[model samples]
Target: MFQRSISYTALLVGLFDASAAVADLTADRVWAQTIDMIEEAGGSITALATRDGDNLNISNVRFTFDIPDTDETVIVSMDGWSLLEKGGKVHVEQPDYQEIVVKVAGQDDVTARLGYSVRGDMGVYSEVEDTLIQTWDIARAEVKLIELIAPDYDPAEATVEFVLSMNDAISNMMYMGNGHQQSVQSLGEMAFDMTIVTPAEDIDLSASARMRGLMNEGFQTVNFKGTPDEILAELTAGGGLRANSALDGMEFKMEGNVEGEVFNVSFAADKASSNVNIDNGNASVSADINDIAFNAFVPAEIPLPLSGGIEKIAYDIDIPLAAAPEVQQVHIGMEYLGLGISDTIWAMFDPTGQLDRAPIDLIVDLSAGVRLDRDLIDPNIEELMEQDPTQFGSIESLGLNELLVSALGAVAIGSGDFTFDMNDLQTFDGIPRPEGEASIVVSGLNSVFDQLIEAGLLQPDQLMPIRMGLGMGFVATGEDELTSEVEVRSNGGVYVNGQRMR
Candidate 1:
C-alpha cells in the first residue's frame, strides 16, 4: 500500500530554537536543489518558479520525467506552494498538492487535488550539506483508500494505456500519528521502466480474478487506455505507516491494449534497482512485471508477520491441482467476508500484523488437473440437522422461529481464503443451489476469540450458536473437540446465510 503525509514538525525543528540559530529558508532554494537532483538523474525537471516575502511562494514546479531502463515517463508537477508564518506558527499555506494524475502528451489525465496542512515551523539557517536526508517520513493516518475509475478505451483493437492519476495522487509521502512505531518517512528519486503496446502480450488474472469471484460485485475499477510504448516514468512515491516510510522513483514498461483502457500487457523494472534501498529492511514484496503475467517479479517476497494487531497473517501455500478434482479454469474466490486490517493505525507497521484487516474481495484462476495445496480457502456451507426427527416439533413448540434467522448470522469469513467469498450474505443456508464445498485455510480464530473474550466483546455461552452455526454438520466427528471441514453436503441440520451489516 502506498502511503502519503505532510511534515511541518521536522521542517520547523530548527525554527523552534530560532531567532539566531535559524536563517532564512527560501522556497526557491529548496525548489532549485530538488530540481537539480531530478535533472542530474537524467530527468527533465523544468518550469521551476519561486517567490519570497512573509510567505515563500514557490509555484508551478512542473516537470516530465523519463526514468532509466523502463519506458513510462511519469509526469511530476507541483503547481502551488507557499510557506507562511501565522501567529508565530510556520505553515505551508496554499499548499494545494495534487495527489495523483494520469498523464498523456495530449490525452485524458486524472489530476487528484489534495488537501495538505501541517503544524510546525521550518527554516534553513545555513546551506547544510545533508539538509535532505536519505529519506523523509511525512505523515501517517488510519484511513486512506484510493478509489479510481478506469480511463475510456477503444473497444475494437486491444491496446494498453494507463493514466496513473499521478498528477493529484500523492507519492513520496511520509506520515505519522497515534499508532505508529517509527516516524514516517519516504525515500527519493526512484524510477521504473516498462513498455506499452496494443494487445497486451499476456497477463495473469488468475490471482486477481479469484479474489474477485467471491464478491458478486465487480472488483475495483482500474482502467488504462493508451498506446504508450516503452513508457519512461520517473516519479517519487512514499508515505507514512505509523513510522515506516518509503520513497521510490521507478521506470517501467507499459502499453495500452485497449484504446482508452490500459489492459492486459506486460511491464518490468529496470536500471534504478541498483540504487534502491528501503530504510526499513523489513519490506517483503518488490518485483518486476512483464508480458507473461499481470505482475512480474524481481526478487521480492511477502513481509514477515509481526506481533499485536500488526501481525502479518498469511497462509502462503500452493495447492496440488493434480490431486484436486478435474475442473476447467476454476473461478476461484475467497472464504472470508468483510475482511480488513484491524482498526489500529499501527497495524501495517507491526512486523507481524494481527490479521489487521481483511480484503473485501480476492480472486484466482485454476487450470484442470491442478490440485491446489494453496495457503487459501474453500468456499463452503455448514449444515446443522436435528439429531432426532421429533426434535423439530419440540423446538418449534418454543416459538423459536425468530431464532432461526439469528442463527444465520453466526458464521463469517475469518480471513485469508475464507474471506474471499464468505463476506457476502452475512449468513447463508443451502439455497436450492449450493456453491459447493467451503474450502478454506484458517488460523488465529482461537486467538481472535480469546481477544474478544478478554475485551468482554464475546461470551463463552455465545460460542455454542456460533460453533453449531459454522459447523459443517452438527454430528460430532471427535469425542470432545468440535471439528471443521472444507466440504458441505445436504444433511438434517439447517443452513444459515447472509448476515446483515451492522
Candidate 2:
C-alpha cells in the first residue's frame, strides 16, 4: 500500500512538471503549452478546449501516463476545470473533486482509485518575459482512497481506507526559461489517516499522522528535451536540485487488533527541519528533530505500557554521485542525545534498580575518501556492475573523528584514521587492507556488567568469555577503566595493545 501511495505521488509530480511550461498569460497559449509539455514528458491528455471570450473552458480533462521503470499506468480525470484570462493574469479554476486511477499490469492485476479535492482557488499565473509566476492561497486540499482491488482479496471481507489533507496553504512558483523552476509553500496543518480491516484474520489496523506549521522551498533545473533516464543523468551530472523544509511539530499514532489482541503505538516530535543540495555531481543532506517522545502498549506481550523520549535526533551525510579521477571526500554524522526509557520498563528487568537510569546517548562522526570508476547515479550502473563488479568504486581512506556511547553507568569513546590498499582484496576476507590505529577508552564496564548480572539480564556464564577477551586485548588504565590501542598493519595484521590478534 505504501508503494502504491508513492507511485501515486510520483504521478502527481509528473503532472505538475507537465504544467510548468507557461510562456504567456493568454488562455490559448497556456493550453497549448500544457499540451506540449505533457507530450514531451511521454504523456497524453484528452480535453475539449472551448474559448468563450477570454476564458477557456476545458472539459473531459483526462491525463494518462505510462510510469517509467514500472508496469503501472496512472489516469487522472476531471470534468469542470477552466483557465480564465482576467486582466493580465491567468486564473486556474479546478473542479472541487477529481479521481485518479492507477492500474498495475501483473499477475494480480491490481487497481486503485484515489479521490482528490480542493476547497479554494488553485492558483493564478502571470508571465514576466520568459518567466511564469504562479501564486496560490488555498483553504484546503485533500486526497483520499476511494477503492482498491487486488487478487485474493474480497472487498466484502477486507477493506482499506486512507485520507490525506492540508489546510490553510499558500504557495508561490516560478517557471523560468531553460527548464528552471522554483517554489515556496507553507501550510498551517497537514494530516493523514488510514485504516484496514480483514474479517478472516480478525485484524483491524488504523494509523494517523499530523504535522503543523509546515514550510518548504525548492529549486531545480531539468533538460526536458531528453528522455526520462537521460534527463535524470543530466540533473545528477550538473543541473542539480535543492530543497529545504521545516515543521513546528509532528505526530503519529497507530492502533491494531489481531485475533483478539490489541496494540497501540504513538510518537511525537516538537520541531524538525531538513535540507538537501545536489550540485557538481555531489549531494549532501542533513536533518534534525528535537523533543521526541514515544509510547507503546501491547497487552499480549508486555503487561505494562512502555515509554521513551529523546532530546534530539539528527544525521548528516555527503557523497559523490559521479565518477571522479581524484578521490572525493564523504562524511556521515549521527546523534541520538538524551534518550531515556520509563522506569516502569527498566524495573521489569532491574527490579532492584541496580542499573543506572541515566539517559543513553550515542554519537558517531566518520569521513572517507572514495574514488569512483563509474557514475553512481548512472542508469546503467547495475548492468555495469554486473559486467565488472570490482570496477565500481573503492574506499581509499577512512577517518573516525568521534564515537561515543553512554548508558547504563558505562561509557565508551573512540577515534581512528585508516588508509586502505584497494588493490589488495585478499588480506581481510576479500576486503581492502587497511593501515591505521584506533584508541578506545571504556569506563564503568565492570560495574555495568555486574549490575546486568544482578538483574539477570546477563548470565554469569556469559561473563567469562567477555572477561577473557578483554584481558587479552585491553589494558587496565584505572579503577573500573579499560583502554585499548588497536592497529592494522599494511601487511593485513591486526594487533591490540601490541598483542597480535590477526
Candidate 3:
C-alpha cells in the first residue's frame, strides 16, 4: 500500500515539470509543456483551459495513465488549477482537494482523496538554458481512502479506513537536458493510520506508524527518446540510480485479531538512515538503525509478552549485476550491538538468576569472489534456472574478515578464508570442495555451562559429550580461554590443531 501511494504521488508530482527551454515563461507555455510531457510518458490529460489576463485557469482536470510493469490504471482528477506568469517565473497552483482512483485488473478498485494546503509558494518553476528547476513548500498534506469496491466482498459488512498525513514538507526538483533529474525533499513529520472492522466475523485490525524529520535525495537519468518499457529495460541493464534517505525517529504499532486470538506488536527506533547506489552493473546498499525496541504479545501462544531492544543495528552489501567470466568482488556485513531482552521475559527462562544478564553483541563481515554466468536481474531468470540450476553463478573464494559473538558471560571470535574448487563437487557431497583454515577463540564457556547446570537449564550428562569434544579439538590459551584451528585439505582431510581428525 505504501508503494502504491508513492507511485501515485510520483505521477502526480511529475506532471508539474512544466518549464521548458524557452526565454520567456508564460502560463500557456507551461501548460503546453506539461501536456507534451504527459503525452510523451504515455498518458492523457483533459481539462477546460481559460485565460484570464496573465493567469491560466484550468478546471475539471483529469489525468489517466497505466502504471508501468503492472496491470493497474490510475486516474487523477482535480477541481481546479491555476498558473500565473510574472517576472520570468511561473507559479503553479495546487487544488485544495484531489481524487485518485486505482483500478486493478481482476481485483478490487481503490479510491483515495488527497487534501493539501501550502503556506508560502506552492510551486515556482524557472528555466536556465536547457535546465529546469522547481521549488515547492507544503504546510500540510493528507490522503484518505474513500472507497473500495470488491466483487466478492460486501462493503456494507465491513468498515475500513486509511489515512496518511504529512506536515511541513519542502522539495526541490531539477531537470537537465542531458536526461538527468534530481530531487531533494525534507519533511518535518509524517503519520499513517489504518483500521478495519468486520462485524460479521467479529474481527478487528488497527495499525499506525509515524516518522519525524525525514530527508531524502534522489538522482536518476531518464531516456526521453525511449518508451516506458524500453526505459525499464535500460534500467534493468544498468541505468543507474543513486538515492539516500535519513530520518530522525520512527515508530509503529499494530493490533489485530486472528481466529479469535488477539495479538499486539510495537516497534520504535530513535534514528535510521540508508543509502543506495546502482551503476554500471554493480550495486551497493547500506542501512543503519539506532536505539531500536520491539515488543509483541500473543495471549494464546505465550502468556508473557516478549520484548527486546538494541542500541544499534547495521547492515551493508555490495554485489555485481551482470555476468562476467572473471571473478567479481562481493561484500556483506551486519552488526547488532547492545541487544537485550526485557527482564520479565528473561526471568521466565532464568528465574534463579544464576546466569549473567549482560546484553549480547554480534558482528559479521564477509567478502567473496564470485563468477556470474548470467545477469542477476535477467527477466527470465526463473525459467533459465529451471533448465540449469547452477548457471547463475559460482563462488570462487570467500573470506570472513571479522566475526564476534558475545552473550551471557561468554564470548567467541573467529576469522577464516577459503577457496572453492568449482570442478570438484563429490568430496563435500555435491558441494564445491573447500580448502582453508579457521581459528576460533572462546572464553568463559566452562563457566557458563557450570552456571547453566546449577540453574538447572542443562544436565551434566547432556553436556559431557560436548565437553569431551571440546577437549579433543581445542587447546587452552588462558585461564578459561580455549583456541582451536580447524583446516580442510583439498583431498577431503580435516585437521584440528595440526592433528588429522578425518
Candidate 4:
C-alpha cells in the first residue's frame, strides 16, 4: 500500500507540471496577438518575445512608423521588456529605452535618449465574458526632448518634459471573430512642462490636468471587416469614423504662464468637464473656473499693476446629437459669474476710495431649440462635411428658450421663438429671416445709474443721455421696471417697444 501511494503522488505531480507548462506556453500566443495589434495601429514591431519559466521577456524590441508619402519616420528602440504571470494576474514592465529618433526628409534628425518604465496588473481571464481584461497603473514615464549627441544641454535652450501617470486604470478588450470591442477607464493626471529660450525671448510654461470619476460607459467597436491595412486606409480617408462609444463623466484643467524681458503674464483655470449619454444622443459640457486669475507685470510705462479677472467664470453647452428638426436642440451659455479687481489695482484708478470695493456679478444664459435637416450624430460625417459645410446643417426653425443677463444690480431677459424663411435669405442679407416677437424686461436701471454716479464713476451729464435713450426704446412696466418689445413681422416689417423701428 505504501508503494502504491507513492506512485499515485508522483503521477499527480507530473500532471500539475504539465498544466503549468501549458500556461507558460500561452504567453507566446498572447504576445503574438499584441504584435498584431501594434501592426494594426500603423507601427512595425520587431522583437523576440518568449517565455522564461513563468515570465515572458522580449529582448531588443524595436518599433518604427513612417509618415505616408513623406520621408519622415519615427523609431523607438528598447533593451529589455518583461511580463510575468502570478496569482492568476499578469504583470508587465519595461526597461528604459536605448534611444528614440525622429527623422525628416530634409531636416536634421531630432533625437533623444528616451527613458520609459511601466508596471501593471491584468487578469488572466475575464469574469464578464470570454475575453481579456487589463488593469494597469503607470508607475512613471518621462520624455526628455533634447538634441541627439549633445553632450550636455544648455540651460537657456528649449527643452520639454512630458509626464503621465495613472492611479487606477482598467481596460476591457473583447475579441470577436473578425473585430474587437474595447472600453477604458482611468483616474489620474498628466502634466507637461516646457522651457524655451532664445536671443529675443524667454518663456516658461507648466500645465497639469487631472481626470477623476472617469468611465467609458460603453464598449467602442473596432470593425475589422477587411484586411488590417485596408481598414487603416479607410479610416485615414475619413470613411470609417463613427461614434460607437460613450463616456460617463470626466474633468480637465490646463494652466500656464508666459514670461519674457518686456512682459510677464500668468493665467490659470481649475475646471472643465463633460457628461455624456451618447446612447440617447444627449450630452452636456461645462467649463467652469473658480478663483481663476490673470496677472501681468510689464514695463513701468503702464504705471499700474495690470491685473484683473473674473472670480468665477463658466460656460455650459448642451446638445442633442442624433435628433432631427422637431426634436433637435442646442443650448449654450456663458457667464462671468463673478468679476473683481484687486484692491491695490482698483485704488490706482479710484484714488478717492469712493467706488464699491465688492466684486460685481454678471450672468448671461441663452438656449435655442432648432429644426435640422439631418442627424448630427451620423457616422458618415466626413462626406457631409466635405459636400457643403453650411448646407448640410441648415436650420428650419428656432425656438428661443431664454436669454438672460444680470449685472450691476440690474437684470434683462428676452426670448424669441420664430421660424426661419430659408428661401428669403437675401432679404435679411444672407441670414434667414425670422418671424417672431422678442421682449426684454429690465429692472433697477435707475438705481444702477444712481449707484454709478454716487461712486463718481459716471457723471450726471452722461447719465442723463443714457436715461433719455432708454425712455425712447423702453416703456415702464412697473415700479422701477422697464419693458422693451421687438417684433419681426411675416411681411418683413419690424417694431420696437410698440413703435415702428423698420
Best by lDDT: 2
Return the clash pairs for model 2, or none: none
Ranking by TM-score: 2, 3, 4, 1
Per-residue lDDT of 1-502 in model 2, one digit per residue for the tens?
Answer: 0111212123235334654543457987778878987997899998999988888999887888886887777666667579999877899898788886766654457778889899976878787667767778788999998988888878899999999999988777776666777787778889999999998999999999999988788888765566757766776667888999988999999999999999999999998999999888889999999999999999898899999999999999999988879999999999999999998898888888989999999999999999998878777878888899778788999999999999998999999999999788899878888999999999999999999998889999999999998888789999999999999998888999998888
Order of models, best lDDT first: 2, 3, 4, 1
Tell me the deviation in Å of residue 315 in model 3.
0.8
| TM-score against native, each model | 0.26, 0.82, 0.78, 0.66
**CA lDDT, every prediction?**
0.30, 0.85, 0.83, 0.57
- Total backbone clashes of candidate 2, pairs 3 or more residues apart or in separate chains: 0
Displacement of residue 370 (Cα, Å) in model 3 is: 2.9
- Encode model 4's per-residue lDDT on 79-129: one tens digit a residue: 756777665545565554434444333244555554443444433422122
Q: What lDDT score is found at residue 457 in candidate 3?
A: 94
- Count of clashing residue pairs in every prediction: 178, 0, 0, 2
Off by over 4 Å in 2: 1-24, 33-44, 65-74, 95-117, 142-163, 193-207, 222-238, 256-262, 422-432, 490-493
Question: What is the Cα-based lDDT of residue 144 in candidate 1?
Answer: 17
State the lDDT of candidate 3 residue by residue for 313-422, as single tens digits: 99999999878789999999999999999988878988888987899999999999999988876767788989997889899999999999999899999999999999
Model 3 weakest 10-residue run by lDDT: 1-10
- Using TM-score as the measure, the top candidate is 2
| Candidate 1 lDDT, 336-437, residue by residue in tens | 122233233334343334332443322232212222221111111112122333221111001011110001112222211211122233335422222333
